[model samples]
Target: MAEKFSGKKFSGKTVYSGITMGKVLILRKDPQIRRVKIADPEAEKERVYGAVDRAKQQLAALYEKAVKEVGESSAAIFEVHQMMLEDDDYLDAICHMIQTEMINAEYAVSVTGDNFAGMFAGMEDEYMQARAADVRDISVRLVRNLSGQEEVDFSAMEPSVIVADDLSPSETVQMDKKRILAFVTVHGSTNSHTAILARMMNIPALIGVPMDLSEIRTGMTAIVDGAAGEVIFEPTEFQCSEAERKIKGEQEKLRLLQELKGKRNETRDGRTIQIYANIGSVSDVGYVLENDAGGIGLFRSEFLYLGRDDFPSEEEQFQAYKQVVQTMGQKKVIIRTLDIGADKQADYFDLGKEENPALGYRAIRICLKQPEIFRTQIRALLRAAAYGNLSVMYPMVISVEEVKQIYAFVEEVEQELKQAQIPYRIPEQGIMIETPAAVMISDELAELVDFFSIGTNDLTQYTLAIDRQNQKLEDFYDPHHKAILRMIRMVVENAHKCGKWAGICGELGADLELTREFLDLGVDELSVAPPMVLKVREKVRGI
Candidate 1:
């Protein structure tokens, strides 16, 4: 007879969203390495180099596969892994140990890996610390290849939620992602590559679970509530049935929403609302269409600037913008120019250390200081405008004088484009009302732009004098403060008075409770995440 096990629940952080029920598949830990004396150091060194070559070839193949499985952006990590494998520091450490210590190739690579990983692990920055995993991953692959150890065959397993102490980016990519229903890591950060892969795979994932693995058994049924960051195990039949019911209900809701795709974005009162999606990259256009967004309210152009050694050229930017504009056809696409700096950093920008980056030079401030860079982006946007409906939006706009200066620069770019005989159009221009200064002078600022999009997230942070990044002050950070609502009302009213439409593209836009309030205040649109598009549309229909 099957032994009856007690039911247990574990709480953790959600890295992605979905509810899934499956059997447990515990990922085995890395095998232990035994140090052995080498009779031939020269031979060990040759073997180590050979392993590197093999690892490189394997990673290259994996990179191509990842590109097809996920997108190029997510797959780029494999390219980075290839570079890490060939890094002089890493190679030199392994070769030095093999030549000097007469150690086996596997032992030398293992020591070198630990040394390099420790260096990164000791870094003060969390992002840099997370990079240590990459070092360890490459080293392990090299060691495995040299030792002739077989890789884990996830394809042989039935569909299940993968439970692990941790998973490196490489491991996550190399695994048979198709068989994995979800992932639950006992040790991992929300910013880790595991989390990124989970998101790219569009599967539910939970991380930072405080669970004792000894208590977990393979083939044990488990329920993962990814949104709530909870995992239930060995639930009663009643509980399992209830969870299945909820899952079906959610699926039904989504099915109904899918039916509403391409439907008119009209409220119950017959008022039209421009429902749009905010995307961070060109690849997100697929989801935008899937959700039937009226248009793209914000296309964060910073992705091109980040994770690179140099600034993106005008041609590079143009091709990207053109692809998106052409794909969207006549649908409006508003590209928000380079909101880098602050939390989002680029080494090439040389945006020196700032005691208060959030309040200091960032976004438009950096762009304005570097006119050549700004002109490059403007030229790209203008050239792309020829293809389809594309509008440009400036972030962190604070004054009428700043608006005037921006116009002056735009005129220069227009003249340059004309002289070059470039075919383009003067698409609609707008500014993000995210600062208190902008909100206070919104009436004057309204007359300077074609429209207004209230960035309620930053406005609330700046107005409340609360640091949104600080978890300790989360309770005090109120997006619903009367001050924020009044500012939104002010921006919307001023926009109307100036013969312009007003929309919100912040987190507050997805707040269903605030939908009627915003509509009542004359807001014309709500731009939200792709997942919230249908929900917001449903709310709009209700109103």
Candidate 2:
């Protein structure tokens, strides 16, 4: 019989909601690197280059696999890894260390990886800090390839709850999804790629669990209650029974939600509203269709610019937009132009540091100043609009002047496309009402756009003057304040007065507590995360 111990419980942050009980599978920690003196520096340098080539190949395969499993937005991390492998600075540092110390390639890679990862970890930006894990992941792969070590194969393993210090994106993607009952980690961020992948896989995952590896043994019974953010070791028979009951409840709830798929999003009295899905990439289109979303309300185009150096080409942007619009067919696909800056930064932009980036240069400010970049995206968007129903929306607009400037760029792009004899159409244009300034002037702003999509996340942050990213302000941050509801009502009234449609494309849109209030306010649409589509629809039906 397997060794048994008294039940112990630990808490963590929930990344996904579900319940499962299984044996514990402790993931092997990082490999130890032994620094060996090499006989020839040149030979070692050649060996390092060879291993990099092999790692690049492996990453390329991983990218394709991830794209198939998770979608392009989540899989883009692998592409970033491939770029990191090719980075001249990273490769040069590894080569310099090997030549200077006459050390083996594996040792050089391990040290350089730590140094680079440390630099990222020390950054003030959370997104940059997350890149530290990426650095470590790529480094580990190179080391394994150099040492002829094989990756852990979970394909043959029995279903179990995986316990790890932290899982990298690559490791999570490589595992067999069917074998993963749940994931419990000692350390990880909800914003990390691994967490994102877990959600996409629809697996129960708990992060930041405080547990000692020595206390966990393979085959030991474990229960992961992701909804409660708790992990129970050597769970008692009663605990297992309760977990099984919760699992069945979840399954029954899902079955009921699935029944609402083909049903219309209409209230009991016949008040119908468009229920759409917010997507980050092309891969999310499948989910949108699966959830029976009437259309895609927000297709965040920034994913194309992220995870890469330099700007995405006009052709690249065109193909991406085209794929989405065509795939969605006649269904409305509203694509927001690049809303880079703020927390989402690309090094190539050289945006520089700021004391208050959230209030400074970003979104429409960057696009207006950098017309060339704006033109490239507009040109692609217009060309893609020819294929199907597609509309464009600008983010961070606070004035009539900004909207006017955007139209001028749109006209210029339209003319260029016409001159080149490219098949294109000027799609319906709109602006995001995210700022207090926009809300106040929405009456005037509504006349200039075809529609309005309220980005409640930023609107709430700006209206409340609270940093949404700050944990310390969590106590005071209230999205349902009377002021916000008044603002939404005001914006909706303004849009309707101008014969324009308005929709909520923020986190609040999915808040079931306020669903009836939003409907009463005459909000025309609610675009939420894909999984929330059916639930929101169910709420609407009950209302």
The TM-scores of all predictions, comma-separated, are 0.83, 0.82
- The candidate scoring highest on TM-score is 1
Which 10-residue window in model 1 sums to the lowest lDDT?
Answer: 1-10
- Which parts of model 2 are misplaced by more than 4 Å? 1-7, 20-60, 63-109, 112-139, 145-149, 154-222
Spell out the clash pairs found in candidate 1: none
lDDT of 1 by residue, 443-527 (tens): 9998889988888878888999998656589688777899999989999989999899989998799888898898889898888
Residue 150 of model 1 has an lDDT of 42
Q: Which candidate ranks first by lDDT, i.e. highest? A: 2
